[model samples]
Target: MADFVKGLFGGQQPAKVAIPGDDDFADYAGAPEPTPAAISSYTDAAHLAQPTGALTARPYTAWYRVWERTSPEDFKLEMYILPFLFVLILVHVWGTRANRSKAKAWSKAHAPLLQQEFAQVGFREGEATSDDILREKKADEYSTYATGRQNVAFIDFKITLIKRFNPFMLLGEYLIPLFFESIPAPAERVEATAYVFDGNEAKHAPQYGSGDAKKVSNSSFDGFVFAIVHKDIMKRMREDRYDISLTTTRDHAKLPVWTAVMSESAEITDMMLTPELIKAIHDAGDSFEALIVTDQPIDQPKTLDDTKPKKRINLSLKLESTYTATLPLFQLFLRLPDHLATAAHFRPEALRRIKQTRDEQISKIRKLDDDEKAEERKVAADKQKRELRDQKLGRLSAEEQRKFLEKERERDSKKKMKRSTVKG
Candidate 1:
């Protein structure tokens, strides 16, 4: 009892009794030894007691710390990329605003001149409010100019002020200058006007050259203004399909040296360029680019079936200023079609020849179109045949597929044999 009390109070230890065959207990054990306590689920009490500083830390400061640890090359790349993107955005914004301001100013300046010519003078297609102009952000929308319609005989008159600050042109204009100063920067803006009118009675397309006499004569002729006729007409001319040439030389003595004509014949050229008209052209000075009378489409046709294009008289001019001095030239251009109808009429013989040439050209084009359609139909039929064969093969067994292929081969052989016999 004394020993038990001492042990309970933790002052004395109890001795263990020795058992016989203790080493042999493992041999007698039926169950496997219990697994050590799993470390995966274990947690330290000390660690749990420690403070977590994440809640009080600043996010931006943490991010900065991560960036500070980046490699030198990576840091340099980041610096360059960030600044470039910022500059690009700034340039785009500035350019857009500059273009808009210039367009608005031009519209205001030209409003009076346009109002005088037309009953309705407004933005392209129809009238637009200040809000509408501000909202237009696209490059194409900016390119389109102000228009005037509801004139006496004219279809529409347009005045376009080309944008000076173009983001697309920035690379060539600004960056290229740094490397090669010798390369001159092209003109940024062009103030141009176009007067359009129907010329249904025009027998043949006629184009006249403009600008300084020496320059006009010496410069190589290219562009739509020079070639008023269709590609078909040009092609035929190249092939020597006609007896007369398309180029009709003007009388330099009677007309200005700058006035060069490309027409169907001398008769049409003579009729088109009268003394009064020549005087008007001469007065217009170097501002004139071309006076085109064409029956061909200005824009490309959407389909092959759209063969017949409308006839029109197109007068292009470069206006240096918003001054009303060029108003008389505009007036003369407007009355040109009327003048042609009343004062100048083509002889019956000349009209007959022009009509005949046009009809022949149309016939040839139609034939080519019919041939293309035939080829398309043939290709479509072949495609359908292939699809049907594929479907039939997909449904068939392996043996049936082999039999079908053999039959096809036999049919093809028979066709070849029949062709050879016919040729013999």
Candidate 2:
């Protein structure tokens, strides 16, 4: 087309020009082709078969390799087994702990008794006042917290054993709370409060604790339970007043010296008074002037009426009628069974409740005693009656009532006839 265009222009076809070194067609003709580098890569593929760098396995295979990584000839069995064994042991320990916790939870599912028990032991949870300071101190001294904020304090309890020239102080007032062996809290305050045992339930049972068995003390002829209480009660003893004298019952007789009481306790439960203490009481005695009480000058109620009138002078030791008997009173009751203490310790309401239960037990025992006595009395009476009745009809069983009746009728008839003849 270019030559034809040139001929029409009268220029004839321009000569075709060829470059000196130019090829009109190259092999493959403009199609893309691989270079030598590509061919070499295919030929060099053999090198890729050998692992690169560390010659490491792929991740999954590497992880699986660890399970059987070592040969039996080189691997120590302990190394392989111990790690797994440790894991199993840890799991077992955790399981056991969990099971124990569950069991404890199940066991305590019904436990809501602490507050009630605190009330039982005379822990006053109510609002306390200055008058209660002594009580609070005593509670602080004696009360135990089982756990958390809960407290445990014993109530005032007393047992009256004997009727004598009444001793001024009861044993219960002097009884102290026992020292807890390993109490976890600190004692901020300590005081002793008067404890009186209600005797309404005194006839029931003695307070025989089942906590642990103890040896009987030969000196006191006391029971195992008494020993437990002895150590605790002895700690509460307060000495008599400075002015109180230990006067001798007999003139010039050697006084019973107060000796240190040897109670069976590693802690050395102290008896505050012995014969020596009595001597001290006497030696320290000072006469107190009696206050002259005038009724016209006094006996008026100031603001509130007190049931009892106050005197100008009151004795240091108060003697309330039927209030306290003495230490020996408790010793007397200590000889009784364990339930008596328990019976004595109960509150009036609680005592009433316990009475039904105790009565059931008492009823059985009482019947045995009553029945045996009744049987003996009946037998003796029957013999005595037979001797008297021998003059009347002679001895006979209850089954011979008809014969006795006939004999009685014959006698009555003879007597009536004689009386009728006398009248005529």
Candidate 3:
């Protein structure tokens, strides 16, 4: 329309201009279409068959390849097996917990029976009363932990009834030592007797132990007779000191046959019985009998006051029957069967607990002994070193003395370092 308007107004006609790139399109449009064979020749078959970088497997996609490799049969099998395995693990855990609970309950139920067994022996559970005393160094916290701590002492308050003294042994050499051994033996003999049996009965004859045994000894009497008294009465005996002495009578009708001063020892009061005194009593038609006398007078408590004056308890250790006399050796064997019978009834768990407590007590006593021994050794070593130093100083000149002092200081420092290393 613009071109017609321009022609009427005497303007020249506008021509259509062609795009610069349309020449190739006009040529191609006039050309014939290519055949299928020609197109196939231009295409690369290998390039299409081979994987491209974009289509190639990657490290991150390795799991997908693994999934593809798995058989459908294996996947079906796992589906049925996995749940059973999970249930098995749960059952195992539950079974373990149930067993633990059952064991704990059983232990709680039988603990009291085990304690009763301990009482059968001389061990009773209670606080320190007037009857029992604990004479050992202990930590302040120990008292607060348990009342049974006080009753841990080996000695029971009541005197255990020993079998009647054998008339045969009274004439034997063994009787001499019973009184003589009461007086401390020679150092060699005492040391030799440290471990009497070492738990071996066949090699060493059954005899009383000395040094090491004394540390963990729980028996009130030495030799064949080991008497265990009741807990209640033992408590009363510890409240006060009483004189226990052996006396012999010239005649059965005579009064105050034997007389001796009472000397106190570890828990029990003792007096030396001379052979001459024993003979005098035997001549008195008393059959060499020893009478035990205690100054503990018996008195009744009029009031129920806790602050009441202390009363001396009249205690007695009497023979059951003078007629049924047995040798000490035979008496020892007789007690063995009684011990066995008592032990046979104890449950395994209770026995284990008893052994554990006994071991703990032994360990504590042993530790205290070791500490005391160490202190004694240290004191002796210091004295020895001091004496040696004095002798060396007396021989040395001023210059030599100075050097000796320096060397001693170095030696002492090294010794201290060695001790610390050992402790660590």
Q: Which has the greatest TM-score?
A: 1
Q: Candidate 1 lDDT (Cα, whole model)?
A: 0.52
How many residue pairs of model 1 clash at the backbone? 0
In angstroms, how far off is 421's CA in candidate 2? 30
What lDDT does candidate 2 reach at residue 269?
22
Which is the better candidate, 1 or 2, if ranked by TM-score? 1
lDDT by residue (2-62, candidate 2, tens digit) is 8787766756434445554566654334444565754554556666676685477555555
lDDT of each: 0.52, 0.31, 0.34
Residue pairs of candidate 3 with colliding backbone atoms: 131-235, 157-234, 158-234, 247-258, 248-257, 248-258, 250-284
RMSD in Å for candidate 3, one decimal? Answer: 26.1
Alpha-carbon runs more than 4 Å astray in model 3: 1-234, 237-345, 398-424
Q: Tell me model 2's lDDT, rounded to 2 decimals.
A: 0.31
**Candidates sorted on lDDT, descending:** 1, 3, 2
Give per-residue CA lDDT, model 3, range 101-204, as digits (tens). 33233223323332332232223345233222221111110000111111121112221211112223224544555687443211100000011221233223
By lDDT, the best candidate is: 1
